[model samples]
Target: MMLPSDFELHRPATVGEAVALRAELGEAAALYAGGTELLLAMKLGVLDYEHLIDLKRIAGLRGVTCAGGELRIGAAVTHRELETHPDVVRELPGLAALERAVANVRVRAAGTLAGNLAFAEPHADPPALLVALGARVVLVGGEGSRELALEDFLVGAYETELGEDELIEAIVVPVGAPGAVYRKFQVLERPAVGVAAVGNLVGGVFDGAPTVVVGAVDERPVRVGAEMLDGAALDDEGAFAALAEAAAEAVEPVDDLSGSEDYKRHLTGVLAKRAVQALGDV
Candidate 1:
């Protein structure tokens, strides 16, 4: 690809400074961290920012912590860190496993989970599992800070609820879903369909309806209604088939190089079933 146009780089020492720069520059500025996505977009001429406010220098924006029944992942934490972090591996191995498979080793080494969600890429893997795990994002801006569900933060493909003056601070995921599993189909650099299933299954039945989320096949991660899997049994093929069908019917995919609409829909079902079965295996 061609080199991106010249842009001023600002290294903010603190979150306040970063937010201030964002507010002052507005749309002319973009937050930078793990340029795996941002730099590529800039180089490809899809985005042209006059200024890039780097958040990496902000000490508050790094590391992972656990408190109040949630895992708080910092905005600056790279995918490689997450994939290898002891806390992540122990608390949410499914997520760690998913992170290990994102893109390739290079992308994972530099891509931030916050950036991945902030970019709002439809073909990503984190959002689906995060959503199924009931993840929320903390956003800081000139007005202060606010938290919202990951599902709500993402508006559509290449779209989000983020404001020009706002930057993500962290992604908060609830703890205790040990049975969660993520499955995807990828023949290209990105997945064609991604699915995540989370629940406590024991004795061939789930304690409650499992939370299922489908991504890549749609503009954003689509959550399959819990009601659809109510009273479903993992041991029964018919029940699994019904749950899979429900997931497939929930996504509205478009034709692309990844596959046709029907093909994506089929993959969604297949992946959804596999995800649930993976949960059973856990």
Candidate 2:
């Protein structure tokens, strides 16, 4: 393995210790969750860190539980765990679908939910699902712990609100928000041109006016509000059209090797329609 220059490694047993170490090291240090993203960035020279804090060995940071009518997932929980966990499948099938839809089985086995969110790759799938679920990220740092809505935590491509000393501790997702559905469109077996879409439905109506989020198109996930649907009924045609319009208006996707802006825009409609249709069936 190729190691970056000026590299130092530290394993902290507690979140408090990790935060203190990060503060001492300042920007020269980076947190290592699963090394799925950080390792790649280091190889590409996109990241420069003199110290690496390993959080995997930390106790009480890798479990799933339900409390206060919400699901709490520790940051260290891997995609494979989420995919196979019976509780997750029963509570949030959309999340399980998104987890399975991530890059291959190997990536799922090693990749952490917090790592994926922290990477903030436009092409990643988890962020969109979490946003649609109205999840909250818990952070621990030198300034003490704080909780931020998933939307507020993610700012732009490869950017987040996490302070240098802050590390995500867990994610809290409210239960009974709405029944949700997720859909993704990929090219061959490569990364998706368009990732997943989640829809939360209420008593014959869209919950909280419904929410639609698209990923892998831009820096961060694009969230579409129910108002964008213009009060369309949750019927097949109405739900489909609403999602289509929201996808187009909500995202400002860029052209890349996967496809063009126009192509992605069109997929926003295509996938949105599929997602709405799926919701209607359930």
Candidate 3:
């Protein structure tokens, strides 16, 4: 990789300052969290900016905690931090496991969840799982803050609803959805297709209305309801096959180095079945 072209840098001590700077510089400025994604894209000549505003210096933009019955994760919180944090372990164990499965040790060490989501990488892991877990994103701009559902925040491949002057402040996930599972099919550590299934455990069995999301095969996660699984038919192999086919047909997989569109569609069914089975609602 080569160095990106010259650009100015600013370290903001507060999120307000970061938003203000972005507003002041307009499209020339980029609010940077970890730079793991931004810098790499710049090196690839896919993205460029004249100014970088570092969010790491902001005091309250890092950490994991619980309040008001939701797990509040700061935008600057790295994957490695979430992977091992005690609070994350107790509150969102499925997410912790997913974090462990991120690219590798070095990427986990440097990558932030907010950065991961904001980049809106079609092949990334967090968005599907977060969407299944009913997560919400907190975005801040000069106008103050607004919260939007994770699925709504994501618009399409490499695109999002994040305003030019807005920065992700935090991600909030609902508590007590213990039966959550993440499963993925990857080649060379990059996910080809991923599935996340989550639901409440009622009386030792998963609730009937589980949320199932398929990712990496499409621009964003595509959710399939448990109704498609058919509780009575879940016991039959043919029924499960039908369910898998339905999920595969639901996504718009693209051809890439990881696999062809057909291969991703096949993986989507296989992984979605495995993920939901892991959650035991099947």
Candidate 4:
């Protein structure tokens, strides 16, 4: 199908060029990553861009590596790539799980991690997982480059801290620190609730406090803090209940055709418990 009448396309070979084009076009231009989300929006008439800056050809933005004991994934790294990456599977199993849990084979092959986070949809799976792992996002823009915690980067549904001319560069996640798990409840392959938990044990006792994050039910991934689990023991029952309550209290879910607000909250609790159980407390 043909795009809307107002759409224009530009392919920039360099990040500098892209930023400059964005600056020149201002609100008239939109960055095109994988075009997975943007194209859909265009088709829906939610977005009308006169210029679409294509970032696909940019160099050095589609690889993964381990550096300084952290996994550095380029912004353009596709979901399929992350799913099959040996380092991701071994070091960040939760992230790999989240990647695999996305829509399906074709979408995974085309969708980019940065694109997913940049779109900042409320139901996206990766943000919650990344926040649970305490990841950081590197952004480049006309002014320069900077890094922001993934937790702070996602402000709300379909919203982010990105400027008009800014682009996500990479994501950095700590490696070899803890065992992690992701639990997702999807209705017919569409996720209704997703929870991610990471655990570290010290001297045969749980240490470093578990990180729990709830996704798909709210505008942004809700992080469950250690204090929320204070009264609960590290065992399965205690951890599960605490984390579930934390997730339930973290956000007010929107009511949609898929489910009701109350239903989403219930699923949040259920997924939270499953995530905790998957992290070995059980």
Tens-place lDDT per residue, model 3, 1-282, is 788999999998988888889899998878788788889999988889999999987878998889788999999999999999998888888999999999999899988999999999988999999999999999999888999999999999989999988999999999877588899988766788899988654444444656889988789989975665534333557656766887888998878789888888888888877887676542
Query: What's the TM-score of each model vs. the native?
Result: 0.97, 0.90, 0.94, 0.91
Clashes of 3: 0
Clashing pairs in 1: none
How does model 2 score by TM-score? 0.90
Give me the runs in candidate 4 sitting further than 4 Å from their true place.
Answer: 202-205, 228-239
Better of 1 and 2 by lDDT: 1
- In model 4, state the lDDT of residue 52: 89
Residue-level lDDT tens digits of model 2 in 1-282 = 456667889999988888899889998888898888888789878788888999888876789898778888998899999988887888887787778878888888888999988878767778877888889999988878899999899999889999988999998988765556777777844445453444555555555455667777777777766564334556647556766876777788777777788888888878866765566555
Candidate 3 lDDT at 187 equals 70
Cα lDDT for residue 112, model 4?
A: 92
Evaluate all candidate structures by whole-model CA lDDT and list the values in order: 0.90, 0.78, 0.86, 0.81
State the lDDT of candidate 1 residue by residue for 27-53, as single tens digits: 899999999999999999999999999
The per-residue C-alpha lDDT of model 4 at residue 130 equals 87
Candidate 3: list runs displaced more than 4 Å.
Answer: 200-206, 230-234
Ranking by lDDT: 1, 3, 4, 2
Determine which window of 10 residues in candidate 1 has minimal summed lDDT. Answer: 225-234
